[model samples]
Target: MEIATYILVPFILFALTGLKVMNEYERGVRFRLGNYSGVVNPGLRYIIPVIDTMQKVDLRVKAVDVPSQDAMTKDNVSVNVNAVLYYKISDAKNAIIEVEDFKFAVSQLAQTTMRDIVGETTLDRLLSERESVSLRIKELVDKASDPWGIKVNSVELKDILLPSDMKRVIAKEAEAEREKRAVIIKAEGETIASVNLSKAAKTLAGNKGALHLRTLQTLNDIASDQNNTIVLALPLEILESFRGKNK
Candidate 1:
């Protein structure tokens, strides 16, 4: 019984040592004798004890937040900006082997690219054409990360920190622009109203009775206001004075 017990103990230890379970989203890279061995699929996988090792790599999307970095604009304005990067490990093998740390390297690349892009664009362009900036950043980041088998899905500007003075200046400029637009709009409205009034005058002049009706309408409007005193100059009153003077 002792001999059978000893034999079963070694067998059980070996069985447990060789067992490895991989999840659905994980791929196991096996190394046999410190040499490359094919990847093992999900579910139960066996490896020789003390002779083989497994490294599990996750094949999932990852979000990397780039810390705020100071950059100078083309106009020589200094600003701090931060961004977020969405990426995925497309080729687990290259991701694990090509770069020492893919995430770190990509982050550093992103930081550099951000500075480079900022240096090439003016502050106004950066604020107004943010989509173009984002595209440029994504392109540069993706190009740099492609070798590591990482796909940068997108790059978004999280925040842009401008100087207080610059902010105040921009605000004032915006206010002035708004005031200018308001004045232009008001002038346009007045011009349109004047044109409409001229058209109505021409129409009323074509029919003298319409002009009298319009004058009566104005009198009615004033009367409806419930005023104490009212003054009106009717065409007949002027015509009667002219007739009396001619006689």
Candidate 2:
């Protein structure tokens, strides 16, 4: 009985000390005697007191804020840009074995990729096509970090700060563009109006009585105004007939 007591007590102590609890969002990368072993799932797990080891890796997605980086656009404009990135570890084993620090590695890769993309794109496209630029950054970063077991979900450009002079210049350019369009539209309307007026004049000239009736209509319109007094003009033939009758 004494022999069994000694053996059982030591076994119970070792077992209790080796107990490891992992949460639902955690995965364990087990290593035995410095050799890579298979991953352990969530819940109570066991490891030998001095022979086995485990590193916990969170499976949840992480949000990383990339700092503003100074970059020159293809059009030679200087700007500062920052972004937010979403990533998660796809393979816990590769993430541990392949990279020294997976989080730092991924972040550095994102920064460089963003700068490179910004350098390649012009200021106009960078501002107008922000979604496309972000998608491009996501793709390049995701591809580069695939070997490190990282999965880049999305990238968002939070802000792009331009130079003060550049802002004023863009504003002026936009204003000029609007003014140009307005001038063109007004000129087109005037041209159409002139063409219609010319056609109406030609039609009226073809009929002799049309001019007389149009003159009467103009006089009638003027007479509608209380402030204006219209005068009548008698034709020379009508005046001669009146003089003859009086004689």
Candidate 3:
């Protein structure tokens, strides 16, 4: 009876000690004596105390904010770029066996990819086509980290900082472009106005009495505003008739 009690108590203690609980979003990679065993999903898991070991990996997506890195664009313009990376472990077994630290590996890969891509892109493209740039970074990092069981969901460029002088130059360039467009538009408007005026003058001269009638209309519009004193002049055609009579 004493032997039975001693063995049963130790067995119960061993079973309890080997038990490990995992959350719903967690997975366990089990290794038996330095050998890869299998991945255990959420809920109650068990492993031998001395011979078996487990590493927990969170399956939930994690957001890692990459610090600003100094990079030079293809145009030889130096800029600082920073981004946010979203990733999660896809394979717990591979994540444990393949990489020393999956999270750190992902972050370092993201930073390296960002710098390389930024170096390849021009300043204008990096600023204007940020979405594409970020997507390319995500793709490169995802591909590179695939062996580590890391799944990169997305990468977003948080900011692109330029030098003060560069900012001023860009502002001046934009202002000049705006002014150029405005001048072109104004010139087009003036051209149209002059063309219409020429057509109207030709029409008035073609008709015999159109000029006199238009002159009277102008005087009428002026007279509508009683605040102004209008100086009325006789029509040139009327003066020409008087000269013809005298001749």
Candidate 4:
């Protein structure tokens, strides 16, 4: 009984070692006798304990945050930029066979590509045209990593840091632009007011009593504020009217 018990325990342990269970999101890359066998899908799988080995790979979309990298823009502005990358493993076999470490390789490639793209772009465009730059980065990265079975879905520019001097310069430039626009608007308003004033003068001269009526309205407006005193030098028209009224 003792001899039979020892034999059964060893057999049971060996059988248990051959069984492997994979989840739905995982695929096993199998190798038999050190030669590539193929992929084993999720389910109950068996491999010879000493002759076969398997590596499990998760087939799911992943988000990778790229660290900030310093780069000089085409206009010679130095800036720090970081981004996020979304990718998935399209082909598990090539991912393992072609790249030593797929995730690290993709990250390094993304960093270099970002710096390259930033170097060719102006600071203004990089700040304003962020979406286009991100799309371009995604395209370049996807193309470069395609061989390693990485499918880059999208890339987003996370943050852009500018120097303090650059920020101050930009603020000053914006302030100057606002002041320029205000001056133009004020000048336009003055031009319109002058044009209306010219028309008003012409209308008053064409009509007999319009100027006197306007003068009376102005006096009325000044008199509405009782706390103020107004001095007026009566015009010759007003004097003539007063003389005619007396006659």
RMSD of 1: 2.6
What digit string (tens of lDDT, one per residue) describes model 1 on residues 97-151? 7898888998999999998999999999999999899899999999988989899
Tens digit of per-residue lDDT, candidate 3, span 1-247: 9999999999899878989999999999888998988888888888999899998999999999998999999999999999999999898888988889888888888898999999999999999999999999999999999898889999999999999999999999999999999999999999999999999999998886888789888888888886858585887878889999999
TM-score of each: 0.90, 0.77, 0.83, 0.80
lDDT of 2 by residue, 1-247 (tens): 9999999999999878989999999899999999988998999989887889999999899999998999999999999999999999999998999999999998899999999999999999999999999999999999999998899999999999999999999999999999999999999999999999999899887875886688788878888888757578665458779999999
Which candidate leads in lDDT?
4
Q: How high is the lDDT of residue 80 in model 4?
A: 99
User: Model 1 clash pairs?
Assistant: none
lDDT order, best first, reads: 4, 2, 3, 1
| Residue 212 error, candidate 3, Å | 7.7
Candidate numbers sorted by TM-score from highest down: 1, 3, 4, 2
Off by over 4 Å in 3: 1-3, 196-217, 226-228, 233-247
Model 4 lDDT on a 0 to 1 scale: 0.94
Candidate 2 wrong stretches, greater than 4 Å: 1-13, 191-226, 229-247
Worst 10 residues of 4 by lDDT: 227-236
Off by over 4 Å in 1: 226-229, 236-247
CA-lDDT, candidates in order: 0.90, 0.93, 0.92, 0.94
Q: What's the lDDT for candidate 2?
A: 0.93
C-alpha root-mean-square deviation, each candidate: 2.6, 5.6, 3.2, 4.2
Model 4 clashes, total count: 0
